[model samples]
Target: MWHAVKTLNAHNGYVCALIAKVARYSVSAALRKESVALVYKSHGDPMQVLKLQKLNLPALGDSEVLIKMLAAPINPADINMVQGTYAVLPELPAVGGNEGVGQVLEVGGHVTSFRPGDWVIPRDAGLGTWRKELVLKEHALLRVPSDIPLACAATLSVNPCTAIRMLSDFENLQPGNSVIQNAANSGVGQAVIQIAATKGIKTINVVRNRPNFQTLTEYLQSLGADYVITEESLRKPEMKDIFKNIPHPRLALNCVGGKSATEMLRHLQHGGTMVTYGGMAKQPVTAPVSSLIFKNVKLCGFWMTQWKRDHEHEMGELNEMISSLCSLIRQGKLKAPAYTEVPITDYKTALENAMKPFSSSKQILVM
Candidate 1:
């Protein structure tokens, strides 16, 4: 009887030890699967609505890829979307960012376009980029070269693409031709200036009169702008000689509407095209009937989102453009815009910082 009792006690002790080991293993596995995301249940003030939530990342599906985010830029359209003013809005309880670069951590059995460790960005805007980790279908991501700089990759899809499209699609421009643009200090404007310079085209850049106008002018000039003038100077007589250095602009890019846009139109050569991409002034783009009739200038508008929808651009074309841009970046012919990196945990600080005026640097959320 004593021997039987001793054997039963020993067996019970072994069973308890095994249970504890299983519990510990389960806990460790759960910790490995945890992730964090910036999410909003509704659209309103971004700082007020965004929340950081903890979640367990789901297992990869047959056609899905698990992405670990690297970096995302805070764009004006993102802010507008959060405020419910953008032309397109994501569903409720959505992620915050629209564009970013991510590293693939895993790929599902059926996934083909990507492999583990590949770099990718969302094919289009509004893929919920402001998260530590996410799972997306294989087709939803645009794979970029692994060797490209991460910061350049993070911002590659929007501003640079917009500039390239506007420069190419608007008018038939050749080497030695000239282009003019307002908001030349902006990301797209800067891109246009550098890109045009690379192609042997000239740019007449117009910027607002700021306290540091001289410093800003020098900065844009350093980026290969043929000429940089103040918005107020666009109406002055001195602009003609500036045009004489090149020629009357054949294509004028207008981002700031109202009187500034009209003044830009005044510089347009006969039969020129002025493309309006944004209206920061919240005012209408009013053109004098005389200029439109006498000068034969054409007025047009470009929204990158709409352009994406209408064209249905294939990946090969985008990949080729991105590769060319990447080469330019590598060779120092193109410079990525200055950016301020904010950690994901302090997203509120990032959102607020992005709205500040005269900062001169984009606020990027880094995970």
Candidate 2:
């Protein structure tokens, strides 16, 4: 009898092994024949370092999901990262994008959290998004609503989240209160205007003077900017009259540093808060001592990556924020920046376009 029982157990183990092998082969068969990536062995000029590689999709591991890239933005941070100047650098031979939207193609047998056909974004930055496909652990992804605009979902995580956090986290702002920001035509700036507009908060926007300055101003105003002015226009004495019509700005979001940031600081009301998120100007932020001492203006900095790192414990709250942002998009309250899409094969053109001077729209890589 003991021999019979041992034989039965061995037979069951053999059957289980056969099932596992068959499942593995099924998954392998399910994946596409080819995959591609934009990879760099070392940081330097992105246009110089990034190259396309064609390869077969590796076997998916337990708790892993294979994703096909949908769209990824060419953000300023992406540019800086390739230059090896950003605060965080991936290990050598890394993928080049930090954020993007992707769809699950296949999942490992052990991955229960996601399935084929779900839309997701990297849970944090540095996921190497500029590619045709990637294999990532299911936990590294955050599911987003698949029904909304593809562009909105693709670009949702960074610029919009920064705008939302700066709007809510910094000051005790109420409806009817005013917010001011430079680089108002930027993705984050446009998000700030639309979000603040949704909340009935007024926005005083600043942008650089360009050949199409008036057209851009009109565009932003349509996005709910209470007022829009050029950086040079802001520094002019005429701003005194401009201030007469609107309440002094209570909060300032600074992306352009140098003289532009200094001017944004100067326009802040007494006890206002200035949050610096970027320095596209590539210059140091300057402020007069009197403004810091007498007016009691507060200067703070925000890095979206660091914010995510610090608040890793608040995932539920993060989900709530993400849901709210998605809802805003579904309702058309929040609009994604204008995007020019490039096929993965045309990445060279996309990078060059993003590097253009005063380029009118954002560039996104689409699979």
Candidate 3:
């Protein structure tokens, strides 16, 4: 009986140890999340520097949320960031995306801003969006309406927001007013055309001469561009014919600086504003003396990142702009630019295609 009692005690102790070990493992597995991200340790050619690596996320904090990324587009700015040429460069050994949409898979106990299944987007640039999953503070994300298309939500924060602000803040444009913009086939340019159209405004889109110019023109026209002209067209005497139908543009949007901007500025209505948002040509904007002195063309620059930072605490206007854009998207008045969705595993292909010239399609990484 003594031997049997001793054996029973040993068995009980072993059972307790087994249960404790399983409990510890269960807690660990519950607390940790695994993710894969496109990480770059140094600035160089993106293809050479970017790597896919598994990431183990720390346990969620009280103000944190666990997100599963849905889609992220490879914008020119993103490419520039990876190349260390963009105005905003994240710290090295960082994930590679700046814009994307994700869905909440879980939220911390004290997190009030989001719950499971809520859709969210980075509140600003440089949140490292090229990943399968992540843990971010609630303040780092902004909730987006989930009913909209995934692709639209994935791309909402930067280009469209820039377009909306430039159109609304730069000029008090009324119906029948015309807006001229270069890089009209770009994502922001497309947004400008469509948003201007909804307000009964007209867009004179200028694109570089391409072999498929006619098709591109028709496509921009279909998106409500009233005029699609090549760089060469902006200089010819025939350009006067465009003004015969529509008044001279009072607001000029310049993404491509240098001669392209000078050409766009030449046609602006007297006292009109030319807001420079990008320097695609890598050249200084040269304003003709006559245009500056006589035309009173106001030349200014806009960086969306700065704008967001300025409005970080005062988000009422920002939220309104986002809501307004989403409403337009639901109504079909606005649409995402032409995009080719590539899986996250195929990021190399997406990155390669995005760097191609005259590639109209935006490369989107779908998780």
Best-matching candidate per lDDT: 3
**Steric clash pairs (candidate 1):** none
Q: How many clashing residue pairs, candidate 2?
A: 0
Best by TM-score: 3
RMSD of each: 15.0, 11.8, 14.2
* Over 4 Å off, model 3: 1-31
TM-scores of all candidate predictions against the true structure = 0.88, 0.89, 0.91
| Candidate 3 residue-wise lDDT, 51-142, digit = tens | 98887776776888889999999999889878977655655666888889999999988899898999999887766788899877787788
Model 3: which residue pairs collide? none
* Candidate 3 positional error at 230, Å: 0.4
Candidate 2 C-alpha lDDT tens digits along 1-367? 0000001122124321110001011233455456677878787888899998764555677887889889999998888777777655555566678789999999989988787899998877776788788777776788898999888998999999999999999898889888989999999999999999999898988988899988998999888998898888887887887678777788999998999889888889999999999888878789899999999999999988767767777888778888999999999999889889899789999999998888878899998
Query: What lDDT does each candidate get?
Result: 0.79, 0.82, 0.85
Q: Could you tell me which residue pairs clash in candidate 2?
A: none
Candidate order by decreasing TM-score: 3, 2, 1
Better of 1 and 2 by lDDT: 2
Report the candidate with higher lDDT, 2 versus 3: 3
